[model samples]
Target: MITALSHPFFLHALLAGTAIALASGLVGYFLVLRAQTFTGDTLGHVAFTGAMAALAGGYDLRLGLFAATIGVALLLGALGRRGRPDDVVIGTLFSWILGLGTFFLTLYTTHRSSTQGNAGITVLFGSIYGLDATQTTTAVLIAAGITTAVLLLARPLLFASLDEAVAAARGVPATALGLGFLALAGACAAEVTQAVGSLLLLGLLAAPAGTAIRLTDRPYRALGLSAALAVLDLWAGLALSAQVPVLPPSFSIMAVTATCYAAAHLVGP
Candidate 1:
């Protein structure tokens, strides 16, 4: 494993994974608190659609993923009058994006001459080992930006998330904070797509946060524990993947995260 660390791809994956874990931990705490797990899952589908669309249009897949997810995040925020987004609106968007993803998949498969039939699979499951230096840098920068934004909004966002009516009555911009947090969540989703892929992203985003919440009632401590667990998940997954080359890193990561969550649940609060 030490020898593998010398490899550029391994190094990139480590850095990128760490950044993603940190961002996911922070954003996910609020995602769980806001009960927006479904929203995060929907964003994964949107990310898949965007990446497919980019491939079909001969653009960078990352661009498509970021643009589509962030746009949807902002739209959801705007449609939401209060901190709580309208479930009906989210349902509508969810169906539309899934349909769009199907269309893009068909378009990509038909027009593309590339023999890589697994391209779509890669988008769905991720190809973290394939991340180049530029992609790693991009993921790290985006993660940093998302983390900083979450920190800046932490206090009010917490107030808004814990009690929307009370926070609004107390003059907190609950609506605005909700929107901003969703936007950050979107960005975090995009960043994580590089590490675990879209399909398995929810595990990475929610598991650590879920475990942390079960273990502690203190918000800051929960956030810290979430980040630490996420980092451990990624590192363990990577190490296991290295030891067993047949396993996909994304699957390994998700498996580790899921196992940890199960263990946490078993232990109880």
Candidate 2:
């Protein structure tokens, strides 16, 4: 295990995965508190469509997905402010984009180069072994930004989440908090897609936080435990997958997270 950390690829992958897990847990805690669990699944699928378009258009898939995800996040925030049910819109939009993805996927299938097709798979299922130094650095930067923002706004965000009506009355700017959290979550989803793929992003994103929240009520403890569990789930999954060679890393990671959540639920209030 110690030697594994020294290997270049393993080191980079570990770095990227750790940062991605931290950000996911932080943002996801707020997401659970705010009742935005659906946003994770929704933004993840949106990334899928953006990645497909990027594949067809010759752009960087991550950037394309990030841009599209941010746009969707902002739009959902606006819709929520206007009293629309964002999840309903998101649910409808998910199928629409997925349909578009399938159509383009079929279009690409006829003559798509294998390299381009592999990019599509990367978006769908992630490629941890493929992470490079630059990508790892980017993940770290994003994680740092997320941590800073969440720390600064945690109280207001929490206040709004626990009691929105009271928070709104207390000048907590609940709508702004909601939009901010959504935007943060969108960016975190984009980062997580780097490690776990869009399909299982929610599992990694929501599970740790959900479990942590159930185990504790204090803000700091909840966020800290969530991040720690996320790191455990992904890193253990990575190591186990490397050793076992039966299950895929992405699914294995999610399984670990789901098990944690289930354990927390079983020991419930």
Candidate 3:
């Protein structure tokens, strides 16, 4: 297993995937507890359009996605809506970004001569074998940052997640917590989107967390289970992608993750 982490391509794939699994599981634990899954879904979809624009501009796609997601998150956090429907806000933002993406895609398609075949499909669905060492290192660093945040802010974050009213009453600063978490969520999605792509990103992030929740009511145990399951799913996906010809790696990972989720639902008590 460790040997696979040495081959140039496999090395990057393994590092990036495991790092993403850790980041997503850790951040997603809070996202799930706060019922911000919709926000995550929207931000990830926004990342797709951001990536497409980045490809067109000859910019680093991951950087572009991260910038866009961070911007969106700040905007949402700054709004700090009072008694408003959060879903509506997220949906509205998602529609605008996706529409912009569709327009850009049309331009890319019309320019055909300048477009690469790797544009939409490879980026949208992902190609795990394509990650390089630099990208893997970046993923590791970002995951480490997220993990540090979890360790440093766990008590307050969990307090805000479970009972914002009480936490705020106790001087927890729920608003600050929400804003901080928004930043964290954007950062998490940006890293994961680089490898899995926007389409399958949510599945990889949400499934493991969802499954972990099904397995245990205890938050810490659920987080550990989520990280473990997510790593297993990613490794299984990489192995399958290697063994199977003409099959995409994202499908393999997601399929295994889906199976895990279904099993959790069936066998969990």
Candidate 4:
């Protein structure tokens, strides 16, 4: 374990993973609290589609990733009542996004597969260990930006999530906060896609937040605890994968996350 720290790849994974986990924890807590877990899940499909679109268009994957997720998030806000994305809005978009993803996948596989065959796979399952120095730095910066934005919006967002009607009545700008949070969540989903891939994005986002919520009824405490648990899950998963090279880091990390969530259910309030 200590030996892995000296390696550049492991160090990069650790740093980037920690930053992503922090943002996921913060944003994910609100996602769960607001009953917006489905939105987060839908964004995973959006992430995959976006990446495929980028690949098909020969653009940078991040360009497609962020543009698609953020664009759809804003669209969801626009389509829903008071900027709060409801089940109907999310469900309607979900299948369309998946179909679009399929179209892009066909384009990529048919044309660019010879050159970038694994690109789609990378977006779906992640390639954290494959990150180079520049990618790692970029991931960390994006995660930091996301974390900062979520923190700034945390309080009002909390109020809005808990009770949109009351929050708007109290002049809390519920609509704007909801829109802002969805956008933040979109960005967070895009960032998480890089670390854990879209397949397990919800696990990283939900499990820690779910565990934290189970452990405490205090909102702020659960928020912080969510972030802490996510970081620990990332660290433990990475360490385990490092010790046992046969294990995939994403699977290991999510396994730890699942275990913690289950433990929370067993031992928590």
Candidate 5:
């Protein structure tokens, strides 16, 4: 264990995974609070399509990832009532995004797969263990930005999420807040996509938040607990995978997350 901790790759995964988990926890709290888990799910697919498009276009994957998710998020906000997307909007975008993902996947496989075969797989299942020092730093920075943004928005977002009607009546910028929150969720989705992959990103976002919500009635306490649990799950999963060579990090992290969530339900009222 100590020897594994000394390895540069493991260190990179630790740093990057911690950042991703923290941001996912913070942003995810409101996602569950707002009943916007479907939006997060949609953004996950959006991230995959975006990365594939970027790879096919020979550009940075981050560009496509951030752009596609954030853009669609804003669109959902704009089209939905009170900036909260309805089932129709989410379902519509979800289908379209999946189709676009297939198109980009085909393009990528035919034209760009020779140059970068595992890139697509990495976006699907993540490459946290493969992150270099620079990638780790970038992940940390992005996650920090997301954490800060979520913290700043927490108060108003909570108000809007819990009671948009009363919040708006009380002069809260519910529409704008909804737009901003969705964008942040989009960013969080994109960031987690790099750490846990687009396929499993929703689990990283939803599970910790859900567990915290189940465990506590207090919103603020639940928020903090969600972040703590997310970090713990990520760290434990990483450590478990480090110890067990055959276990994939993503699977390990989510396994811990699911277990925590199940325990919370069993314990909570």
Candidate 6:
């Protein structure tokens, strides 16, 4: 395990995964509080479509993933200002994005040669081992920005999440705060997609936070627990993957996360 840390790829994975886990844990607390796990899951699919579209257009995949997910988050927020998001609206957007994803995948396949075939798979399942120093730096910067934004908005956001009517009565910008948080969540989802892939990102984003909330009613303690558990999940997963070279790190990470969540349900307060 110690020897694995000496390898460059493992180091990059460690740094990138840690950054991603921290941001995800923080944002995920509010995501569950706001009852937006479905929104986060939807964004993952949107990310897949966006990445495929980018690949088809020969553009950087992150640009498309972030742009599309953030754009949709804003749209969802704008449409749901008066109340909770309508299931019909979410379903519509979900269908539209899935259709677009299929179209983009088809287009990419038609235009690109066999050498580019793995791009879609990479987008779907992630390619964390392929991350370089530059990408790791970018992930860290993005995570820092998101975490800072979350902290700055923590009190007001918490107020809004727990009781929106009261928050609004108290002059909190509930709508703006909600929108801002969703946008930040979208960015977090995009960054996480690079590590855990779009399909499995919900586990990384939600599991640790969910477990923490189950174990603790105090908000601050829950936040701390969430971040801690997320880091543990990431590190343990990486260590397992190192031991079993045949297995993918993302799979290992998600497995650990799921296991933790299950255990929390059984043993947590």
| lDDT (CA) per prediction | 0.89, 0.83, 0.81, 0.91, 0.91, 0.91
Q: Is candidate 1 or candidate 2 better by lDDT?
A: 1
**What is the per-residue lDDT of model 4 for residues 1-269, given as tens digits with 9 covering 90 to 100?**
88999999999999999999999999999999988898899999999999999999999999999999999888887887655556886898788998999899889989986876677788898978988899989989999999999888888888888888998899999988888888999999999999999889999999999999999999999999999999999999999899889999998998999999999899985
Q: Which residue pairs in candidate 4 collide?
A: none
Clashing pairs in 2: none
Off by over 4 Å in 6: 82-84
Better of 2 and 4 by lDDT: 4
By summed lDDT, the worst window of 10 consecutive residues in model 6 runs over 79-88
Model 1, global lDDT: 0.89
lDDT by residue (tens digit), candidate 5, 1-269 = 79998999999999999998999999999999998898899999999999999988989998999998999888888888655457886898789888988898889888865765677788989878888898889889999999999999899889888998999999999989988998998999999998889999999999999999998889999999999999999999998898888999999999999999998889889
Residue 74 of candidate 4: its Cα lDDT? 85
Quickly count the clashes in candidate 6. Answer: 0
Between prediction 1 and prediction 6, which has the larger lDDT? 6
Please name the candidate that would achieve the greatest TM-score relative to the true structure.
6
**lDDT tens digits, residue span 3-46, model 2:** 66677887888888988888788888888777788978898988
The lowest-lDDT stretch of 10 consecutive residues in candidate 2 is 108-117
Residue ranges of candidate 5 with Cα displaced over 4 Å: 82-85
| Model 3 per-residue lDDT tens digits across residues 1-269 | 55555678887888888888877877877777778888888888878788778776767788778888888887777865565557886798789998997776666666654655567776678777787877778889988898788768878988888888999899998888788888888888888887788878888778988999998999878878888888889888888877774668788889899999999999999
The candidate, 3 or 5, that scores higher on TM-score is: 5
lDDT of 6 by residue, 151-188 (tens): 89999999999999999999999988999999999999
Q: Estimate each model's TM-score.
A: 0.95, 0.93, 0.92, 0.96, 0.96, 0.97
- Residue 224 in candidate 2 has what lDDT? 87
